[model samples]
Target: MATANTAPNPAQDTLALVGRILIAYLFIPAGIGKLMGFGGTVGYITSAGLPMPEVAAAIAIIVELGLGIALLLGFKTRWTAIVMAIFTVATALFFHKYWSAPEAMKMMQQINFNKNIAIAGGLLALAAFGPGRFSIDKR
Candidate 1:
């Protein structure tokens, strides 16, 4: 029988570190922007037909900042990534329903929807694979 290599790979570790950092970069600023524009975020959410827009906006800020920071530090990596994956998908569904967009906005909405899905896929990968040697999770 052939045995699979069950060893640490430096390249894989480095790549995981880079991926985590990049994802964090994407989210942290978004959280900060939402925090700074709380009223706008609430207005946007209301426009999307969601109830309690203020509450939704608050939850989004918390999740984005909390999970984004945790992912940046590689803390509770697996669960954090999983939660992020869920959050990404939910936002994509609620906020970027490109199929319903008016023609002119369809293309942009479609692109945003696809990007959110792709990010969720990446988060799922992080959940499947540990945060790697460079992470606080490793310590």
Candidate 2:
């Protein structure tokens, strides 16, 4: 009887590592920005007219920083990726929607929205593929 190969594939490992690093790289800045109060993220959230801007900002910062670190460490990668994906989508819809913006600002809004969408796709990929053998989740 022929035995099926159970060895881990190098290419899959490479892809997972790349995905983890890439997603982590993208989120770290946003997380740090929130933590450092750069670019007025909290103020910007308030200006967006959300009911509780402080709470919203805090949640965003926590999720981005906390979940991002978890992802980079490859701990609970799939759950963290899924949470980040949802957060990304919500951020795009709430802050980056261009339709309500002044004509002059519409282009920038659209760009931001598109960028978040792209990031969300990467997170989703991580959720599906996991962090592989190079990660903390390795079997």
TM-score of 2: 0.87
Q: lDDT value for candidate 1?
A: 0.92
Across 15-125, the per-residue lDDT of candidate 1 in tens digits comes to: 889999999999999999999999999999999999999999998998798899999889999999999999999999999999999999999999999999999999999
lDDT of 2 by residue, 38-129 (tens): 34876898788887787898889878888988888898999999999999999999999798889999999999999999999989988976
Task: Find the candidate with the highest lDDT and give its number.
Answer: 1
* TM-score per candidate: 0.94, 0.87
Where does model 1 exceed 4 Å of error? Answer: 1-5
User: What lDDT does candidate 2 reach at residue 56?
Assistant: 91
